[model samples]
Target: MIIATGATGTLNGATVDHLLQRVPAARLGASVRDPARARHLADRGVRVRRGSYEDPVALRRSFADAEQVLLVSSSDIGADVVAQHRTAIDAAAAVGARRILYTSTCGAGFETPYPPLAIHAATEQHLAASGVAWTALRNGFYGDLGQLLGPWQETGTIAKPADGPFSWVDRRDAAEAAAAILAGDAAFDGPVDLVPSSPVTLADFAAAASELSGRHIERVVVDDEDWVAGEMANGTPEGAARFTLSMFQATRGGHFAHADPTLVQLLGREPRSIADQLADQNIG
Candidate 1:
């Protein structure tokens, strides 16, 4: 059977749905922190089991009888994310899983201002040393940028702490691609970057927003310190705000600018671009 962690999350949940279409539901299992939350998947013939990265025994049980395990990277800020990922990897390996696939990001590496990059890099190293075959799906940056970018429709300005030429990808595309990798028999020994051939900067986003909204949207660069302070004032946790800051710093350094056509090759078509997203969303 194939097992997937973080079944309740958007990306992983979408991946599970795609997997169900590609393979038999009996061959799929979802390891979630709370089995109760995954009742829908359980009803669909998936073996929903309680599993947490913090608990190794539960993870082992959840991963039992699995030939491959899709391990979602931990998102616990201020926690030992690397160790948590290692624990999950070790548990999957112990459960006799022949192969492990991790949802890593394209920013993974040592030389980056982004803090999560180090965590992802360390996790990749641990997975490589676990004796089992591993694949790191280096996904592009994916998230809702409207909040950080402010209400351009109302203010006609997109203000952000950092301006990035990020290769933002749709989570649905990435999820489907991941399911394809898990269900197919193609061997990918190491890291594979799931990014598009093109990238869009914040300026490009402003232009698209302007066109879609039929208004002149200006790109405004806010002060770094002031941006963090404002985010905190708006009730965002200090650590979360700082993490966003580091992301901008990393982006300013061109860490997220690197684009590749691996995603297009995986899906046999061009991945949806940020412009398409703007046109479809209500924010634009």
Candidate 2:
């Protein structure tokens, strides 16, 4: 049986749905935070079990009678991600899962500049030490959703602190990749970066978006001092704005620019380009 965590989340839900088509409903289980909320999945014939990152018991119970478990990372901020992942990993191992697939962040090596990535990198290291067959999908940024500068995108101006480019992957593609890995078609024993074949700078992205939307979008770069000032002037909370700006600054340093060939090979075709993805969404 294939047991999947984070079944309620967008990407995870999509992954489970794809796998459900390939595997029978009896062979599929979803670990959700609330069984009541998973009525939709249950209606589709998935076995639903209650679980959460904060509750290891729930996870242990959820992973029971499962062969393969996909451990989707938690989205909690300010908490110890490593600790949360450890809880899920321990539970999966206890249930004797034959293999584990973890959704992780891209650029998981020690030299990565992004500090948030450290949590995932550490979790991957721990998973390796757990003596289980493991595969890690070190994912890139999601391209379907716009950033916090979303409102700015509508106004034909993107004000960000980043100075460089980012190569983002469509969440749909990431979900499909997860399904393929869970199907046991791709054989690997370690972590792999899930990113596109190419990247586009933030400026280029904004410009292309403007062209697609028939707007004259322009990049308004903000420095450290001005970033806070602009945030306040724009009615943003000081603390939240500072954190968001810092993430952009990291991106400017090529934090999200990692490129890999694995995505194309796994999908057996070229991953969607920025323009192609936007066009599909009718954003252009």
Cα TM-score per model: 0.95, 0.91
The clash count for each model shown is 0, 1
Show the lowest summed lDDT stretch of 10 residues, model 2.
143-152
* lDDT by residue (tens digit), candidate 2, 118-157: 7778889889988899989887777434654465555777
What lDDT is obtained when candidate 1 is compared to the true structure? Answer: 0.89
lDDT tens digits, residues 1-284, model 1?
Answer: 99999999999999999999999999999999999999999999999999999999999999999999999988786678888999999999998999999999997999998888888899999999999999999998887867656777778888888667777888988998899899998988899889878777778888888888778999888999998898899999998888889888988888888888778988889988777877667666
In angstroms, the error of model 2 at 202 is 1.0
Off-target runs (Cα >4 Å) in candidate 1 are: 232-239
User: Cα RMSD to native, each candidate?
Assistant: 1.6, 2.2
